[model samples]
Target chain A: MRIRERIIETGLFFSALSSVFITLGIVIILTYESFGFFKEVAIVEFFTGTTWMPLFAEPKFGILPLVSGTLLTTAIALVVALPLGLISAIYLSEYAPHRLREMIKPVLELLAAVPTVVYGYFALFFLTPFLQNFLPELSGFNAISPGIIMGIMIVPYVSSVSEDAMKAVPMYIREGSYAMGATKFQTAFKVVIPAAFSGIAAAFIMGISRAIGETMVVAIAAGMMPNFTFNPMEPVQTLTSYIVQVSLGDVPHGTIEYRTIFAAGMTLFLMTLFFNIIGFWLRKRIREAY
Target chain B: MTRSAIELKAEAKNLNFYYGPVHALKNINMPIERRKVTALIGPSGCGKTTFLRCFNRMHDLYPHNRYEGEIILYPDKINIISPEIDPIEIRMQISMVFQKPNPFPKSIYENVAYGLRVRGISRKGILDEAVEKSLRGAALWEEVKGRLNSLAVDLSGGQQQRLCIARALATGPRILLFDEPTSALDPTATSKIEELIIELKNEVTIIIVTHNMQQAARVSDYTAFMYLGEIIEFDKTDKIFTAPSNRLTEEYITGRFG
Candidate 1:
C-alpha cells in the first residue's frame, strides 16, 4: 500500500513540476529576446516615442502606435460588449424559463466556439462592404470592423461568466428583495446586481484580457499600418498583428529587427499580466463578500 | 371563545400539497389568530415547513410544485391560489426568516435597511431610525450599534441570524413566518431569539415551524402537533404537552419515535 501511494505521489509531483517548467521556459525566452532588442533600441524611446518606422535606415523603434491601436480596439470592444453581455446574462439567469434558458444558453455559447478566423473572414467579406456602402470613406480594413467582430466573439465570454456569477447569488437575497414589494427589475438591479458586482467586474476584466490577446480577427480585418491614429475608420496595426507581420518576413535571427517581435510579445504579455492580476483581485473580493 | 371583529390574518381549509405525486401536506385546516405565536411541532418531513411556506405563497415560486387548496386572508378574501393576486404583493405582507442566517454581503446598517430601501424609503433619518429600531427589536442593537458600517459577514453565526431577523422586521409585515429559526443557533443565541419572538408576539402574528419540542412548549401560546403532514393535535401549549389527544403526539413528544 505504501509503494502504491508513493507512485501516485511521484506522478502528481512531476505533473506540478512540468507546469512550472513550461512557465519558466516562456518567461526566459521573452526576457532573452527583450534584452537583445533593448541593446539596440533605447528602452525609453521604445516605450515613449511616438514614431515607429522600423524598416528605415535609422529604424526609429517607438511602439506607441501599436499600443494605441490595441487600446483603441479593446476600448471599442468593451463599450459594445459590457452592456449587451450583462443584460443578456440578467435575462437568461433571472427572467427566462427553464426550457428557454436551456436552449438559449448553449446557442449563445456557440458563438464563442466559432473560430476567430471565421469571424475575421465574415467581417472582411460581409460587414466592411455593407459599411462602405453607407460611408464611402470607411477603409476596407479598419479597426471598427475588427473591433465589432471581436466584441461579438467576446460576448459569450462576458455573458456566461456573468450569468454564473449572478446564478451563484443566494436565492434568499432575491427573496428578501421581493418580499419588500420591489418589482422584478428592481430586485434584479438593486439587489442581485449589487450582490454580484465583484464577479461581474472580474468577468469584464477577463473579457478585456481576451480582447487584448486576440490575434487572428484583428490581423485579418485590421490592416497592418503602424500609424498613430485613434480613428477607428483608419487602417491600424495592433501589437499581435505587428508581431505576425514581422514573423511572416525573412528577418534574420539575433538581429534587432527580429528581436523587436519579442519586444512586442513581451509588452503584450505584461499588459495581459496586469489584467489577470486585476481579475484575480476582483474574484477574491467577490469570494470574500460571499 | 369571544372573538374580536379584527379580520382573520390567514385561514387554510382542507389544503393538500403534493411533491411529484407524494403527498406532503394532507388535509390541513387551521386559522391563524392575529398578534399571537403559533408553533408547529413535528418530526422531520412532516411538511411543517411546506405548510409555513404556503402562508406567503413561497412554495408556488418553484415549478411542478402543486397544491389543491384555498388559503384565504380575510378583509380581502384573497385566494392564494389565484393568478390574479400578485405573489410579490402577498409576500410583502408576509415575510419569512429562513433556517439559516442568509444575510446579504452588505454592511450591518444596510442589512437591516435593505427591505425599507427596496420600498424606496430613501430618507436617511427615517432609515437610521428604522435600522436602530429593528435591530433593537431583534435584541441585536447593543452589540452592533457602534459598528454599523462593518460588513455583516464579519459577525458570528448567531449575530448574522439576528441581522436576518432584523432585516425581516424592517419591512413591518402583518405576519412573520419562521422555518426553524433557532436550529442553526447555539443554546444562548437560541434563547435570545426565543425571547425576541415572545416580545414580537404582541405586534405581529407569527407561525413557527420547529423540531424542538421543549422550545415549542416554552415559547408558544398555541401548539400544533403534526404527523405525516396532518395536524394530529392542536391546543394550548400546556394541553398539547400534558394531555395530547393523539397517541402519536404523545409518542413523538416523549421521544419514542420521530
Candidate 2:
C-alpha cells in the first residue's frame, strides 16, 4: 500500500513538474533564438520599419505589418465576440431555463472543440465567397473573412468564462435587483454585469489572448503577404501566419530568414504574455473581492 | 380585547407554496398594515424567509417553485402572485433588503439610483434629489454624503445594509421586505438596523423575517410566530410576547423547543 501510494505521488509530481519545465524550456529557446536574430537585424528597425519583405532582394525586416495584421484580426474578432459572448452569457445565466442551459452550454463549447484548421478552410472557401456576394470589393483572401471567422471561433472562450463569472455572482444580489422591480435585462446589465465586472473583464482578456495567439485559421485564410495596411479588404499576414509561412518553406536552419520566425515568435509571446498578465491580475482581484 | 380597525396595505390569502414536491408554505393568511411593521419570527427552515419573499413574488425566480393562492396588493387590488400578473410590476411597488448586505458592487450613488434607473429616471437633478432623500430615509446620509461615488462594498457591513435599504427606498416602494437583514451583522450594526426599521415603518409598510425573537419584539407592531410552514400565532407584538397563545408559539417563544 505504501509503495503504491509513493508511486502515485511520484507520478503526479512529475506530471506537474513537466509542464513547468516545458514552459521554461520554451522561454529559454525563444530568448536565445531571438537574441541571434536581433544581432543580425537592428532590433529598432525590426520593430518600427513598415516594410517586411524579408526574402526579397532588398530584405526589409519591419514587424509592424505583421503586428498590425495580428491587431486588426484581433480587434475584429473582439467586435464579434464581445457582444455575442456577453449577451449569450447573460441569456444562459439569467434567462435560459436550467435544462436548456445545461443542454446548450456543452453544444456551444463544441464550437471550440471543432478543429480550427477546419475553420480556416471554412473561412477561405465558404465565408470569403459568401461575403463577396455582398461585399463586392472584398478580396478572395482578406483579413475580414478570417478575422470574423476567428471571432466566431473564440466566442465560446468569451461566453463560457463570462457566463461562469456572471453565474458566480451570488443569488442574493440578483434578488435585490428583482425586488426593486428591475426586469431581467436591466438586472443582468445594470447589476449582475457590474457585480461580476472583474471576472467578465478577465474573460475578455482571455478571449483577446486566445485571438492574438491563434495560428491555424489566420495562417490558412488570411493571405500570407505582409501588407502594412489597416483596411481589412486587403490581404495581410499575422505574426503567427508569417512564422507558419516561413516554417513551411525550406529556409536553411541558421539563415537570417529562419531566425526571423523566432523573433516573430518572441513578439507574439510577449503580446500574449501582456494580456495574460492583465487577465491573471483581474482574476486575482476578483478572488479577493468575493 | 378591543382594537381600532387598521387600514391594510396587503394581505396573503390561503397562500400555499411548493418547491417541487416539498410543501414549504401551507395555507398562510395574514394582513400587512399600511405604514406599519409586521415581523415574521421562527426557527430555521420554518419558511419565514419564504413567506417574506412571497410578498414580492420572489419565488417566481426559481424553477419548480409554485404559489397556489393570492398575495393581493392594496389600492391596486392586484394579485401579486398571479401568473397573469407580471412579477416585475409587483416588484416595482415592493422592494427588499436581504439577509446579508448584498450591494451591487457599484458606487453608493449608483446603488441608490438603481431602482430609479430601472424606472427610467435618468435626469441628474432628479436623481440627486432622490438619492439624497432615500439615503436620509435609510439613516445613512450623514456618513455617506461625503463619498457618494465610492463603492458600496467599501462600506462597513452595517452601512452596506443601510445602503441596500436606501436602494429599496429610492423608488418610493409601497412595501419593503427584509429577509433576516441583520443576520450577518454584528450586535452594534444590528441595533442600528433595528432603529432604522422602526423609523422606516412611518413611510412604507415593512415586513421583516428575523431569527431573533427580541428583534421582532423591539421593532414590530405585529408579530407572527411560524412553525413547520404554518403561522402558529399572529397578534400584537406585546400580546404575542407577554400573553398566552398557541402551545407551540409559547414553547418556541420561551425557547422550550423550535
Q: Which candidate wins on DockQ?
A: 2
> Which candidate achieves the best lDDT against the true structure?
2
Each candidate's B-chain TM-score, in sequence, is 0.94, 0.97
Model 2 lDDT per residue over A183-268, tens place: 88888888888878889999999999999999999998899979999999989999999999999999999889999999999999
In terms of TM-score, the best-performing candidate is 2
**Ten-residue stretch with the least lDDT total in model 1 chain B:** B1-10
Candidate 1 lDDT score at position B150: 94
| Clashing residue pairs found in predicted model 2 | none
Model 2 TM-score relative to the real fold:
0.96
Q: Give the alpha carbon lDDT tens digit for every residue of B7-96 in model 1.
A: 467778899887877889999988777787899998898889989988787866677787777888865788775667778777778878
Runs with alpha carbons beyond 4 Å of true place in candidate 2: A1-11, B1-4
Q: Candidate 1: misplaced stretches above 4 Å?
A: A1-12, B1-7
